[model samples]
Target: RVIPAQAALFAHVWLDPQNPPRAIMLQYYRDGWMHRAVWGDYDVIPWGAANTTERVHQGELPALGEWTRLEVPVEQLGLNTGDALTGFALTQFGGHVAWDQVSIRGTSDPANDPLRSFAAWWRSVAGKDTPGLSGELADLAKRGPQAEASVEARRRLLNHYLINVCADTQRSLAQPKAELARLQAERTALEASIPSTFVYRDLDQPRDAFVMLRGAYDKPGEGVQPAVPAVLPPLTATGANGRATRLDLARWLVAPEHPLTARVTVNRFWQQVFGTGLVKTSYDFGSQGEMPSHPELLDWLAIEFQRSGWDVKQLMRLLVTSNAFQQTSQVSPELLARDPENRWYARGPRLRLDAEQIRDNALFVSGLINLTMGGKGVKPYQPENIWEPVGFAGSNTRFYTQDHGDALYRRSIYTFIKRTAPAPFLSNFDAPNREQFCTRRERSNTPLQALQLMNDVQHVEAARELAARMLREGGDSAESRIAWAYRLLLTREPAAEELAIVQAQLTAHTNRYAADLAAAQQLIGNGESKPDATLPADTLASYTLVANMLLNLDETLTRN
Candidate 1:
């Protein structure tokens, strides 16, 4: 909405123990997009020199810390009358030029403004959308020199201005209170009038499909109609015109007669809850894919799933609540030798949590979880300049600013996922780049995963907060507190041997923290969550060490 007509850029800058030379460029954007032509480069060339001029000031600039005003006039720069000016940009390049109190000023020009009052009032007077309202408004702006000539013409434009913009009240420059209130009402009504629905359109004649020779882009083949593969179920008529469509293909895939339909559906859901799909290769169910480990069990589950009208939640509930799912994960040597991957359902599901769940679990156990479900993705704690080093300069991830307060602790699913630069810990743990459908996520064991669990900022913060809770809420003795932590984190009490091991680690860490109070203080207060001021640094630090070990354990990272 800025009118840069006769406008000027001004800024106060100070350079003391700083770089000797710096240049400021005045860049302009049409609307908001900036390009080579609109950059308006070489607008202001200020430097430290021993001289003086009328428009330029220079006299052996003060060596001590001192502020100097730099200005650039719009006339001197190449500014177009048609340039619907967006904003001013001041960029300093050289060693360093610290700036303060920057501004751009100019007399208003209605032609360059975004909100055309004349256009708005014309539309209101016309009582409907019309081409003349816009065409006449454009004609008025072009009457630059002749604008103030005709009295009647001036009055018409003035009336339009008053009705659409602000009333030209001489009493005050600011908008009157009553008019402001009316503005709020109008805005509310306008917002409410906007329909909240979506419409999709289809072509009257659907486009024909063709196969490329050897999948070559340039080679063309005979046109084909919408179809399913010959090897799969034959498609049925679903579209209005009765020709089989992609939608028809979808319907045919789920038809009861299709042999692979229900079986594949149940197998994918089983994989989600039980670590491995029954077919092993969920993406491929043809002869090329792995055969089902328990074919009869797969068939029975598929039949039940289909009978329930494809009730996904009910199927999942039934699967998890079954007797077979609750068995202990531990395996005897003979069973391990017979079925290495436990394909025969010999044991309960036991595998590392998915990338998202790993972070969610840490937040959940620490009581720092933001349970708010489904919203815009949030930026969580990430290493500084992590994106910069990799040339990730997208709008969302140019500079990773960690969200504050509860947002900083939201579920990992809400973490701002940039395709170019995924969250480090999640990416390290094999989270996908998401360019295509993620049929499977391969799990990897690496030093990065271990390091992240022990030292990533969020994980460290979770450990500290969890340790604080353990110290304040857990029983007095170290053994009792360790046992309490185990139950809270894992939903089960630790064995006697596990308790003894953690207890020993706590005693060793206590001595280590007691020897260095400063190191202990840093560990106890690692994140935004305020540390328990009541607990001694040594106590929290000792427990943080034990908590760190507990979080890094295979049992904590895996779901069993």
Candidate 2:
């Protein structure tokens, strides 16, 4: 092959991180001589040249452990436009290297390019061109392939050519594409407008059930049938075929005589309200699991749950209204020593709220929560580029675009979840990514959780909104405002000492903000919502700090 003028040779290469190649060498045979270019970690070569006629160009190595496109102009490798390139070789010394897409590309004249010609024809036929499209064309022409235009610039030019310059084939297919899109949209609308549910039906000729030998599906040993465990009650119900069906299984699970279903359901609900279930191992009910701390209470609750027809709301009401649930969480030193984990149920539930509850609580107190019911998931504030590393390039969820207005303030239940990259604010507080079923979430207390409360955009904005509410609705004096916030956050009036401490904090913040209004404005300018322009910035900012402090208090976060 003959070398073309203004052509560059490029190859996508990946080097091993643990054992990278000592050197990468590209050799071109021209005019009976081998011209070589080398890139390696060392500045000078440790080995002498194989032949006196060989020409070498030494360069530095690129990054290791990632695929990178490396390109070099043929002219830089001592090749002329008319030179005959008989062969080329890539050589590596030591370790391993992988290469792909190795080829030579030549510069194309902008005037003769197909895309430019199509654009000119489209402009003459359409009689107009958008400013953006025209600008991209001009930029591409100015920085042609010879000038090494960037990949992004080339992509933009191609997009403009496809969107703005319609060829004969494109014009022919436009109507059909539009019609297909309309039909798809109509189908989607019809699907959403109707209600649907899943119903199980037995096959006419059901497949034989076999017990796999050593859990290998292909190695079957013995046949089996659909029936309850031998230890429990039998499944007597049958289908039209005279065999037990899925409905029979369902009946057996919820039967009044069954031992596990009602007990497990009530225990989970109890765990939801309290921190732990009576049976500490909620996922396991076998002999291997821990026994219930109070067997009689468990039995009674399960019986009551079954009697109420498994009504979850009624069960919740009954539990919450009980005297045991209403007991004070405060414990004496002796009691704390006797039962550190409260396994004896001597006190009420007192633990930090879960991730969703904590976020929703903040939004509720700040009055920023949007009470809209039923919609698609929403995107809330999260750290920038949190999804880039774990996300696929062409995936719809690769980019995390924060939503605006009400979407930003929706309940945490409506927050969009990406299995690869869960919301950072929630994850920092122990929210699962939801890749698999989670029976119990592990709670951890760390400085990072406190940092999220004070610094995250959502929490900071919530604090600002709460501050504004306190200023506008609370009484004029500082004491009144402090008392009002205390009541609103904790559902009780502040103690005299607590009130005095808050007053001192407010006074100190007010003096500092009063001196530096710029800092105060910066502090309040956190979220999409604007601060109250009518109120003084310094005063609002001072109160915002105080509100933030109140939101982060242990008492406020605890469930009791």
Candidate 3:
């Protein structure tokens, strides 16, 4: 504490009965000289200076194990206002003692008149007039601290006064706070302006590793050295320190002699295109994993991948351009019965698109997808309050605010993902929760997936936009419009039967909407995109239903 003139130090201290302190010492600096004040029965050493002062207070020491008040005046310790109190030491001879509520205050009779003492202390500390403080103090003083209700009221007034004091302190600190915020923003900008990347750096001395017993960290069984698995090729590369480094491990992974790395890498890419890996268990390549369906083909592809210098684009081109990949997915019932999963390369890949692919496909066909390359994630429309149940009150994601304009139309890759409550449109299509690493996503067909495609605002808007495109670019006839939409969505001319079915539905919708113009307006206003003013509302709404039907078709959702 800083010394105050005519003030005394007060403390409540408890001394251990088994080991009471032999003495207590208060050391302070006065006029650039050190002085020590000793209490209790103990020897006082001059320490080659005349500044040492001793006071015998054996009678004042509290009874052992009982809390007692200890007071020392500044004058007795040769201290004046503004002098620095350097240190306070208890039981210098090694004893356990606890100190509490230590404070320095002027000599005021707090026991008899605490309200005035409290006001004085506030004035001394605050050093300025605070708004509402005087009224709160007066209200508290009037309560008198008597009955339980009065005590509660007085406590509330004190709390309110303290809150005001804190608010005043905050106001006083506003300039510094703004300066700190500006400095932090400047630091962040400086960091972002500098180009940086992470690189591995070896420590001067390698840390020793040990195998744990039963995987318990504390139960280390045996020391081990850096090496690859014994079943595969040994690690031959080493750093200048004659130890294997991360660089050496990296070189070993891509080395032609290594058997597993190239195979695993090729398998993962193959799985991305084929919907299943050759080994079935893409993440696990162990003894318990399924054997490769075509071992020779796997080896040949692995070698070819390594030979291409691991060019992913070249590998994708080779895979997609192969005869096996281009085969028709349709098969005879006998062939399907023999190989339901197509593990024998019996047919081309036929599977539903992933969640991101499904969303992006709709936007792409509707000409609403923003192809902007890099930025932070964007928020699109989702059901209201979906995140509230799973979100913490203090979390930034407690409220989901949908974005507008271009942000609403960015690619699905740039969609902001909240782990607790993922976008319902994506989750309903079996998107992973992202809580752990996923080598392969599980695909499931459910009614919710179809419902999302049919009713979601994004999809509905996409359909409306698609309908606008069909009306404007399609020939000026209903049959021509239906054929144009089928080609745009399915990438093929619709069969006569399929064309007739859609035309009939469009006619029925047009009749139904023509009778109810409000229904037509509501249907055309499903999305943020403005409807084309030139097109009739009933016509657009009729075509919107047709477009939604095409978007939800199995052929549109699957890659065959």
Candidate 4:
């Protein structure tokens, strides 16, 4: 009998096991040298079982004098297609186990063994070559599946395997037009036909248009139809109406040789990442627009982007990883004097995070940011009655009822936007009011922005929440708590100067809050979120003030 590793009693043997030892394993493997990946492990045996119990790991061999087979899935061992696999190992703790016809065999042929074939098929991207096993294997896999169906389906398609074939449906439905007509007639005679309402639906019909005079409802002008503008390139394709639709226009726009489309798209993407496009004016590439500084580089990028099937993410990766994108934005006095706009790209992008980011950062840093992406826009806490005077008659944008719980703390993008009163915090930070099509937001340095960051109810609440997190999660020392807050809010470690300033503020606020405990209570209990009652009122208020100072700093607002 083989003795298990009792030293590692109930050890999480995440690594490949040569012999079965009782342990619980999990996904997400990272051996320092290897890439962190979603790894599969052999099933966990019974917890803390000394003797080889009835509960065996998935690939465990049945203990007996007779020979037995153990099938170990390579994928489970975290190796994928085309990976170099070298050898295996055997371990016998009690004594040297007898080995006679011990051998490992793998084959390309599916018929040799069903279990091996199933594993091969599971890892592979393909339809089964064996017709008999195809349906049976798929059905059997349905009994107890671990992985996602879509994940497996994607693998099959990649390897040219058919996910499924409706052979029975095809055979049963086979019919010509005449056969179908006869069958329908027979069915009509046998069964009573349900009465249906007739209504006009879509058809290939000409839709005429009229030019309206003045924006009046009654005003109409000469009849017109779909026509391409004389200036731009002509549409390459159209429908039966001989009118170019949006789809046709879209198709032509992304066509390989389309000059403006790729250039325009790349330019916009460049602007977002680099804070300025090659052509300064992102919205326009007309004759009025600024000429590209690096025309050659822009063209090359556009061409490459087009070649990659207009892969936006790929293009973004290319831009962000480039040398030009990596430089520090710190400006020298000489360069500042010589190039006011920094058109030469002498430095990297140093931009103030726009309104949404400013508020979101406050929420995120404080550990109050709800990360549920893509849902109905919620009404977050706005200033008391800000929307009261801001609307039109018949507009349903009346109440400024604030959302409680998670909705109140959702990402700023999901904050409900009203036309008359756009989400104020973001709008104050130069986020567009949606009055017009703004390709690029114009930023204005104003006292209003600074004031909002400091005193806004949302921001104040975020500070308190952050203070709570720092109190709970931050380590023992004052320095550690301050450092934790700084790192959490800002992606980097705090500079000595920045750290000193925050530490000083924390000390000052701690003393101040201690002197006025009632004020501290009021300060920490500002918004919808509950106060962290476990924390002392003075400490909570002090941390809140420190967090507030951190959030308001120009360094915190700016994206490095």
Candidate 5:
């Protein structure tokens, strides 16, 4: 079996009964090894012949949980005829891991091996032999339309493998931590050379760009000289040699003479904070989009942003620290009648948490969140068989493992995103398709979402874990536990009525499932299996059903 995560135990030994037995040898080889840290080459078995050693991916740093294959040559390990060959040992390693498939083969020729063949085909595509791909596609096309599509899909898969290999190789040669430190120091020196205060400067050189005909780089149109748009006044070129760089662009963007730039940016920022900008189309302030609802307020903010030297932190402090932002989201019928969308910012917006915030909040309440940032992406726990079409015929299968350690608990933004496959929980909550630029994501509610909250293994596990944490940290009383649960999950103490309601529910559950203590405990405890019981099966079932219902309530999902 493929060992999940970083390390595993592996070994092989041969038994030759005839003459003096030959010394045993075990060789570990990875198929299509993309990340160097995930596998090792020809290290002498640290433990003598037959024993298992903890085989780590070359470094302690975690992996991105890509599909990787490992192999142990059983025959080469020196086994005589009729000697038993124990498959290598693979132990649990931290972080999301996946094991493909394991095999023990007797052959010495790597060319005939299935995994080696698959790996070779992969590497061959990466190496770029168009004939192989074309031939396969042609054969597939002759079969039927579906076959042709399959061939094209395979080609895409091969292309992705090529990109990943190229990327991994480049990363391998890239600067390590020491090099990064040196680079940072160099950057600091460079910044010191330049003045921090914004200054007006002409571009050093003129820049020219060409429009792509039909948006294809292969079909370029005539070159267009850099100049302000025709609708705006002509730019007054300045300095010894006229040019247009970001400095010129920034100047033009906020120049007192420029009409749209400041207004657009200010409106966009306002939209970010208030959910709706003065102008509905923040990005497109063009004639086609929605007109500003409060043009004067937008202009005021724009002027402020420019006057403050574009210090975003200061602007945020001034805006959010104000009483207007602090107002509760509770909407009076009068306010709702006048502005159902809450356009005036008379009250805060009642919002559903973003995908990242939702996952982070879940882990935070479970006491399992790790406040780490900035590194290679880690794969979070996902359901089995989720990577079906992506790993279809001839491609390596991906197995997802639960991350039990620090890596599992990182902020959701840092998780790896695949265009073809995304983390299920986050996707349900409207995480974007990273294949394209996304300014805003849609918020949706559906039965599927409720099903996920109620039945998804991860959410269920998190709830149980949170319950156990409350039991441990709270005083030994129902009221205290109820209050603690609210504090961790909602960041506030439960209201008196809420506390009473939850306490009553807990008591009812406890008494009802008295004969099934094991099951009851499992329902409340983290990482514990739900126990099977004879007498209180129905009662245990009832309590669990109710607990799941509470977890699925609308209040649980909404941030407000």
Candidate 6:
């Protein structure tokens, strides 16, 4: 959580009366300043109180109920294997309550745990399951020693060990002070056997690498020294005085004399603003790549980038805020006939929000976003199962330890990136696969995406939370609630027809769930509840269904 730089204290308790976390220590990743860590779900104690011997920061009252970052170790909490921290409740205790991204992990190898493994398996089974039949595991006989059984047993054991190792304590290796010192000296002596640098001769003489026959060291073919491509002008040996090095290569690529540099830069800028560059192949200037539609313009921008000291922010700002970029994406038949792809930037790009932007925008407008900037990578909320390693690769489970909610809502650019398991929402919206050179991304439309918008748990929760916030922030009138929803979702006042539709929708839902205020409130899944009877499970599901409809509308998904 990226908290405001305000004077506040935060605290956490692993063991509480009503909802004690399965783990003992809450290892808080907070820095001591404006931020602090807080905990919740202590039903036995007063709403804002808990029993714990942990030290609180001095001169400040703890932000007991408010969501804040804190650290607790398992040894202190007394929870062993098979336990888990289900949730944390943030309370302001009669103060402003703001909470954002929250997640839990073990002090050690938490990613390998069984519950998470099960969750991943559940996610992989796409579509509805058969009403009575179990999936893969159910198909296997209860008692068997077949090859498939062996694999399944291995998986079960691995998951079991993960949970046990994380939750259970075990004897750790330790050494006496004198013996430890002796071992350190011995290890140092062993390390001294290897040289700091590799034993090799510098290629002092000018030599070019030959194509190795059979990839064997002794089987060198015709030499091909470093030089500019034949299609481009020949390289002059002046810069390195006839020697070749990476510096010389970089200089050649960036030199104004080079034909592709300026052209590539400008085209990329155009693509960034209008969704398609002049050349369409921004990085590739090879013969196989597309030719620039506006060659002159491409050269112009490239030159400009160099002249501006490669100021990326300056270039982006100019492009995004321009009339060309901002033009309404209302399709005109005549314009479409003239330029269907909008190659000339006659109209702005009408693109669906990229994954991170989609999540960020929803969270931001709903008033839940914390805007802390830059730090170690924090884990974006993910479905519990998605972190599992399928077969070969190790788990890529690096996550951030945020001090406050603001850090969680910082722009996705600063989000921690892992080579394996990039956030799903971002990937769904065509985030570049990190494995390759991603000069451009494929804009794909698929049913999987539609399903995600309709049913992904996170979006459903956001919708409910935002809806509740609209109700709370708006006045008592339904009109006020409708207005607030419009402002939050569309960032503008609702049109008269739009207001009428919203009124009808809200009224219908209100009446339908009149007997169950809890049901109506549950429509927003933030877990905050209003005092009322619970609605039928189906009624709450209806609210989500309606929210999904809203999310799927062309207007909601598209940028104008």
Leading candidate by lDDT: 2
Name the regions of candidate 6 deviating beyond 4 angstroms.
1-208, 212-219, 230-241, 391-410, 415-420, 472-476, 517-552
lDDT head-to-head 1 vs 2, winner? 2
- How much does candidate 6 score in TM-score? 0.56
Sliding window of 10 residues with minimal summed lDDT for model 4? 1-10
Q: Which of candidates 4 and 5 reaches a greater TM-score?
A: 4
Quickly count the clashes in candidate 6. 31
The digit string of per-residue lDDT tens for model 4 on 268-355 reads: 9988887788999988899889999999988998999988987989998998898877888899999999987778988888888878
**Alpha-carbon lDDT of model 6:** 0.56
Better of 1 and 5 by lDDT: 1
For 1-560, candidate 5 gives per-residue lDDT tens digits of 22222223232222222321112222333332111112322243344322223222332222233333444333323333323223433322222333434444343233422133434434333434434345654344234323335655666644543433334433664557458779999999999988578775544554457898999988879897667888896676554456445556667776876787667776666666666777877657787888778778777877888788877887777777767667888888998999898777788856676778766776777666778767767776777777675755654444444555577677887787666778898788888866777666678977888787777765665665565555567667767866766665566787888777776777677676676767665554433344333324434344444445445656666745
Task: Write the candidate numbers in order of decreasing TM-score.
Answer: 3, 2, 1, 4, 6, 5
Segments in model 2 whose C-alpha atoms lie over 4 Å from true places:
1-189, 192-201
Error of 1 at 423 (Å): 0.6
lDDT of 4: 0.67
lDDT per residue for candidate 6 within 302-402, as digits (tens), equals 77788887788877887788788888777789989999988887888987777777777766655556677555666555555544553245433533232
- Residue pairs clashing in model 4 are 126-161, 127-161
Model 2 poorest 10 in a row by lDDT:
121-130
**Residue-wise C-alpha lDDT for candidate 1, range 69-111, written one tens digit per residue:** 7665644444443344556555554545566776666765554
After TM-score superposition, what is the CA distance of residue 40 in candidate 2 from its true location, in Å? Answer: 63
Best by TM-score: 3
lDDT score of residue 93 within candidate 5: 24
- The lDDT values for all models are 0.73, 0.82, 0.79, 0.67, 0.57, 0.56
**CA shift of 300, model 2, Å:** 2.2
Q: Rank the candidates by lDDT, best first.
A: 2, 3, 1, 4, 5, 6
Q: Candidate 5 at residue 90, lDDT?
A: 36
Residue pairs clashing, model 2: none
Candidates 1 and 6 compared: the better one by lDDT is: 1
Error of 3 at 118 (Å): 39
